[model samples]
Target: EDQVTQSPEALRLQEGESSSLNCSYTVSGLRGLFWYRQDPGKGPEFLFTLYSAGEEKEKERLKATLTKKESFLHITAPKPEDSATYLCAVQGVTGFQKLVFGTGTRLLVSP
Candidate 1:
């Protein structure tokens, strides 16, 4: 069976604070890991795609890194505008790469 879990389902940060969100998973055959950011009532916005262990990607204040069993999203100096629900998803090496998504981490950055 495949499963995904994210920790600290919600986080509150003051402006300029930094934190890391974790995404843990168990799967049969790993193909890729994906990170997305979703604003209220909106579809997810693609952030990164990690293919293998030691792979990493970054944009602006966000950095995503992957391991064999988990992945992390590191936010640097977060701002109030960065408040959103961050989602993690995994794709297996079986059949069209179907994705399994974790309950998102709701981040609140207050000014």
Candidate 2:
């Protein structure tokens, strides 16, 4: 059963605080680990593509790292405007890009 589950469900952070969010995945074969940031009214925006354990990517205050069975999204010095839904999806063995997404972790960054 290919699936993804995010922890905490929601998180609250004060501006300038750093925190890490978790995403666990279970699948037959992991093709790629994807991290996306979704705003209130728009589709997810791709943040990172982690291919293997120890792989990581970063942009501004967001950093994403992947392992065999899990991924972590770390936010540094987050701001109120950074509040958004963080979604994690994993690509399966199938050739198609049918990424199974976790429910998402809603983050509310307050100033």
Candidate 3:
């Protein structure tokens, strides 16, 4: 079976706080791992794409790293503006790319 799981469904952080969010997944054939940020009432915005283990990508206060079975999103000195729901998805190459998304991690950063 193929599934994606994200921990701590929700998180609250004060401005300047830092934390890491986890995404655990199991797929028969992983073509890629994707990270996205979704603001309330809006569609997801692409963040990163991990095509293999040991791959990593970063932008501003966020860093995403992927391993064989898991991925991590690390936030450094987060700000209130950084608050959003982080989504993790896996794509399998089964004739085509099909994305399976995790429930997502809602992060609230208060000033």
Candidate 4:
């Protein structure tokens, strides 16, 4: 079974504070690790896509990296707008085309 799970279900950070969130997974063959930011009552916004281990991508104050067993989302100097549920998903082998997802890490950035 391919699955993704995130830790620290929720996190609080003051503006300008930095932190890292983890997303662990179990799968037969890892295709990709995707990070998305979802605001309350809305759909997820694509963040980053990690294709292999040691590969990293970044935009604005957010950085994402992938490993064999896990991925990390790092926020630097977060702002209130960055306060959103960060979702991690994994694309791997299944019966058909279905993505395994992590519950998500809720990040709260206070101004």
TM-score of each: 0.97, 0.96, 0.96, 0.95
For candidate 1, write residues 27-87 as lDDT tens digits.
8888888999999999999999998999989999999999998999999999999999999
Q: How would you encode candidate 3's per-residue C-alpha lDDT over 74-98 as one tens digit per residue?
A: 9999999999999999998673788
Clashing residue pairs, backbone N/CA/C < 3 A, model 3: none
Off by over 4 Å in 2: none
Q: In model 3, what lDDT does residue 74 have? A: 96
Clashing residue pairs, candidate 4? none
lDDT of 2 at 28: 83
Off by over 4 Å in 1: none
How much is the lDDT of residue 2 in candidate 3? Answer: 76
In angstroms, give how far residue 39 of model 3 lies from its true place.
0.6
Candidates ranked by lDDT, best first? 3, 1, 2, 4
Residue 37's C-alpha lDDT in candidate 3? 97
Give the per-residue lDDT digits (tens) of candidate 2, residues 5-111: 99879999999999999999998898899999999999999989988889889999999998888999999999998999999999988858899999999999989
Tell me the spans in candidate 4 whose CA falls farther than 4 Å from its real position: none
- With candidate 2 superimposed using the best TM-score fit, by how many Å does residue 63's alpha carbon deviate from the native? 0.7
| Residue 99 displacement in candidate 4 (angstroms) | 1.3
